[model samples]
Target: MTWITEFAPTTEGLNACIDCGLCLPTCPTYRLTGDESASPRGRIAAMRAVDRGLMPVDDRFAGVMDLCLQCLACETACPSLVPFGKLMEGARAEIAAHRPDTATIGKRVLFGRLVGFRPALVFLSWLLAIAQRLRLTDVLPSSAAKAAALRPVPIPVPSTAGHEWLPEGEQVGTVAFLSGCVMDQWYSDVHVAVIEVLRTAGYRVVAPPNQTCCGAMAAHEGAAYDAARMAERNVAAFAGHDLVFVDSAGCSAHMKDYDQWTEGGSDLAVRVVDATEFIAGLIAKGALPAAVETTEPIAIQDPCHLRHAQGIIEEPRAILRAAGLEPVEIDPTGMCCGAAGAYQLSHPDISDELGRMKASQIVATGLPRVASANPGCEMQLKTFLDDGVEVVHPVEVYWKAINTRPVRQAWRALKTVPRRN
Candidate 1:
């Protein structure tokens, strides 16, 4: 229960921060509040204070850590290469163990217990959908109202049956697809789009059965052990595949670090690739079909995980451009849409501020359709943007343009894939 064994591993990362104040301009919270405690340097200072026994792991210490979006923008700007994201995760884990408040318990129950269970999220989405249909979402609490407002339309969970879709003559590679928890439930349309785009690119797809959540939500909420458990399951589930593709930016970014969780994690991590990154590679090699042209300007809202976490800033844009859609960039620094997986519920005020800021940036581009890679980001963007403006995944856009091939009856197994909820 002591601090050393609990939080010592992150001490090196904390000590590595140079406190140069270079990250201030990049930090969303620091920019909003102008408080040192909210910036990366300030949070690291608090971690160092607790590690040195100069400060206790009290509510005040937890407050500073909770305020962080974990966007990792500071890490991108840091000259010292400090592992701020990992350090913040470790600090949050310690806070979760030492300080269990109502909000903490709520997050643990929602993220730890419910998020990974596919059945629960499916049912919750169903109920939310019903609530929206009945015009009852407004009666919900503020946080629930925000989430409810995001997803006006809910899609049923898609079956994750093993699919081996091959091109008519050529087979580029056999890749496994990750049907993430929420991704499969709420945004199954995007999954369908991903499959079509991959198939069109000559890649044979293999979606493993019995896949679980990628644990990004749990990990971000300070449940590292639980996240590790999910990682081990995924590592074993996705074994033997030459490459594993994920459309969800957060899931891809988190899974790419599976090596830190258990044995053979790095093996799985290396094989993991974002769908945009993979399709963009196909475009680069001229293996995919001709670009499907469009004249409408498409505003690109880069997901923080895609841009900052994985350094995949251009692949989504590249894919959009190759599809003949005009790609408009907003916030080159990859500002977070504040949808850090249940962060809106945990930190409603800050989440709203960041979400509004992101929506405004997209609106300023004067585009009606905005392309993003993450479902959470899409939801966040939709929540704050005008009702007519569509927030869709870049893959969805790419799928629309190049998907001229008819659905082969054999590949239509997913159409009737059984639903549990």
Candidate 2:
């Protein structure tokens, strides 16, 4: 009945918690439920007990662990620099090793077989888009309807795979792009924006068709095997490129920790950078043109992965400022919007409550447009926020600002190299 594996939490991470109570205020579940079992400290305590054989790894323990948003806000607040995110993933992997229920089985299939396969994911997205257009989701059960509603209007995925975009005049450097699973299928426009912005910054962008999912969702759900396989594939796909740019916050954070998943991953992990972070660096170098005009204020909703996990809080804001947009902070506490990957679909009730809370904070800012780096957060905000509110990636906003300038457009037209396979 023991479920301990190499993926289970380590004693070092468990013992690192000093019971400081600092993480209590940062945990969304604890703040919402006011339960000790919901907070990071409490969860660590349970993990310790399970590690020591004092507590059984039963359904109750799994429930407690699953309740967490795994947003890693607590890790940001922890002075000890505890690897809580890693520990949590390990614990979940252990639980998944022992628990093989209907839900877990479904997740395995979804993350392993479907999300890992780009074509299958694209086809599924097409089906979802059609279903949404036909209003067929309304007829599904409540849970299924909620899942279906998460999909944004699907756009044609640009032909970027196996192709490269060369910057005009002089290429600064070459960087690989991760056209992620859901990102490529549902939010392909963001990829286009990222590539355009990067190209504008004088970097050659390459989309390797061999790259697959970053395995963030699988790792989050305890499918470590699938995640490791993905890490290996990505490491090989993006090999020889010194820098790899990822547009999705979740994928960026996960890829940054690829070393933890597979050997040779550290080589890829060290090179992975968030697209916004890369753009911010380019702005600092004055490689990109200055903004000709300023836009209206936008509410900046920090995705948990970007703000907390990667410690990339100011880069996106700097990019917005460089693009001549006023960036408004929605929540200083860095609370989760409840869209923790597929967390919204699995825990819709808690997800909705947190989504409403985040949406309210954004609405209070009174900004018509919101910049969120992650697709999940953007979708969650779109679902809960008013119809007048707009959610877009920061790079998308930057692309718009630069693309609208006449001189820049002229320069782009002359300098932009055609896509080459």
Candidate 3:
């Protein structure tokens, strides 16, 4: 095998890299280290070297590759369509294949077991909640924490773990709502709001049975085999739906690239839609509920996956604008919030710097509420230390506010619909 094939590289994957370096200004690690090795192109070159046997998959290779936040910023900036996200994921898979057991017992906490099971997620949520209730966070020493920003945002066990689904009257189409691995524990309400917003737009929303984490986590961690199994499960489970609505941008973005995950590819690729895109689609069709009257400013942070992976730039803003709120854009140009999966835990220093910068931008907007699509962003942004700034999902932004009567009224209609759909 040649350079391209050594690390399980594909001709298509390598061909995708045009080396324009549009990703340079946007890469957080590159911005920090000012090293080519930290840039996406530099890392790609290293992967190529490892593939070609010009370089060993030694500590140096791992050191350079591991520096990436893998924020997908490059994907948005790339003119070559490099699929840098998958490239990094593949590189990690290469690393993990040759790497040692790095997962701590707590960190590993039944990841395989929780992959497909909701009960495990619920249990973890309760555990996190218990840790919170016991003030265990305060007891955690400095050694246990890297910085205030890198600290884990434990998932709360909500008063209602999840609300019972009620579709509003007649449905427009069928959709399967994916309960993600972490979101089920942290921002499950955003998903609940997704269902509410969808039903409001006249869709029959269903949480697909036995759905698991979209294998994005495993794929990025180099477990493509496990990732494929998760994707296959979702493909089969959501087979007959008119659409599959994934609330988390990260999961939706990865699933959209299902072709890359499977050697044989999946047919369910086209039906998957991100929540923002779907809601925006409803707005386009004039099925969107009336916008709410708001007297507040909403600071918006674009998730890299939503913006770059899916080419989704406007739907979320359309939802916010139609809802009568001012959408204040965070003007970092092309920065990621550094919550690219578990990057915060893996590289705390860089993650903290990015998170603080992002939070400061949100705070400068002087908005009491901040909204984004991905749950990882939600958890990461929840640590924003500004006085009185509450971060929320855009769906939650509308559903929780009383001023959005049409939106809420749409939810009212959902309560009256038949549930067995």
Candidate 4:
């Protein structure tokens, strides 16, 4: 029977699944639950059933879709190259459109509207900062509370103005940097580190003032229309630049597929590169110095988006090695830390379980520091791990080791420089 639903999972995508169950072993949920339904293969079967009208897009279907972390671990594991992530997102889009309960509507508004909207996001950051200072975050839901605990001090709106970093020597090229929604307000220091790394590579970095979020959170949750709108806005924001560098793994992964969301998205999507990839490229070209004797052993926690979605397995390690630091590889294949873009809030038990497991693995290495690419993964590592263990973006570690002065001092010195238009 032909599928009549407007946003039905693509038949070709569903057909690509060979059902070999290769994804079963890699799936975090399946590993946790030992249930087929939690596996990617099982989820694909459910999508097929819905497409054939054999199953309704009811609460069960919603549960199946929502329970997924969308880490794309299955996509990496699938030998058939089945676009399981896209199919699951398609099914979720249908569910979101047809079923509009109060909870669903509230989440749709929150993720779709407020989260990516810069002004709203900044305002919420301020509110969260206040909540955190007052110790009122305990009243918040689990995931939010955890996020608040990990959040760096909020930078006010005035300080949110964009900056352009001019390369000191002969410029390699010009690129636009995406200072992401929550990232800018909460983790501003990381953005600073990203700019410093770019500067060190001799690349002029322009951070457009009016940029919005990359909309990965929206797309993952099936808010297709909002995600598309966000993609269009970002494409327009960084239109003139040849390269657009994103430091956030989730944001970079989502922006790389911006073409799928909007009409002119390819213009931006094609230019998008992950910060680690860009820095690694610089190191390979000898544009940046190598290996500055870090005495401590560092552990690299591969963010799922970087490792699975973007296929960036080696660049970070290469960067670590270049910085004169030894990277400890975690066991069990660097599985998801359950910070899959708010998955911790939605499925606290599984999220916490995965997080604890990851923390255990990191601790086993006996490393004082853990390096990760994504802000969420870093936050999760920080929240779940031992207090003595410090979690940071890999670039931050590299930046600290490479720069002569302290990172904070270098960041402050950079901030004093005016944006070079």
Top lDDT: which candidate number?
A: 2
Please give, for residues 98-171, the per-residue lDDT of candidate 1 as tens digits: 77778777777777778777778778878877777888876877677665555554545345645556643456
Model 3 clash pairs? 93-222, 168-414, 172-202
- The prediction achieving the highest TM-score against the true structure is 2
| Residue lDDT tens for model 3, 291-408 | 5555567889998888877878788887776666778888647478877776766787887788888988988887788878887776677665553777777767655542365546
Query: Clash pairs of candidate 2?
Result: none
Can you tell me which runs of candidate 3 are displaced by over 4 Å? 1-7, 103-113, 141-166, 263-265, 292-295, 401-421
Q: Indicate whether candidate 2 or candidate 3 has the larger TM-score.
A: 2
Give candidate 4 misplaced runs (Cα > 4 Å).
1-7, 138-141, 155-161, 292-294, 405-421
lDDT of each: 0.79, 0.85, 0.70, 0.82
In Å, residue 5's CA in model 4 sits off its true spot by 6.4
TM-score of decoy 3: 0.86
Off by over 4 Å in 2: 1-3, 137-159, 292-295, 405-421
Candidate 2 lDDT by residue in tens digits, 1-421: 2546777888888999999999999999998899999999999999999888888888989999999999999999999888999999998888888888888878878886689987787688778878778888768885465545454555553335678889755787899989888787677788888888887778888889898999999999888888889999999999999999999999999999999998899999999999878888887776676564556688999999999999998988887887789889888888999989778777889998999999999999988888999988987888788779888788888888778768587756655657579
After superposition on all CA atoms, what RMSD does each candidate show versus the true structure? 6.2, 3.9, 4.7, 4.6
Whole-model lDDT for model 3 versus the true structure? 0.70
TM-score of each: 0.90, 0.93, 0.86, 0.92
Superposed Cα deviation of residue 241, candidate 1 (Å): 1.4
Evaluate model 2: give its lDDT: 0.85
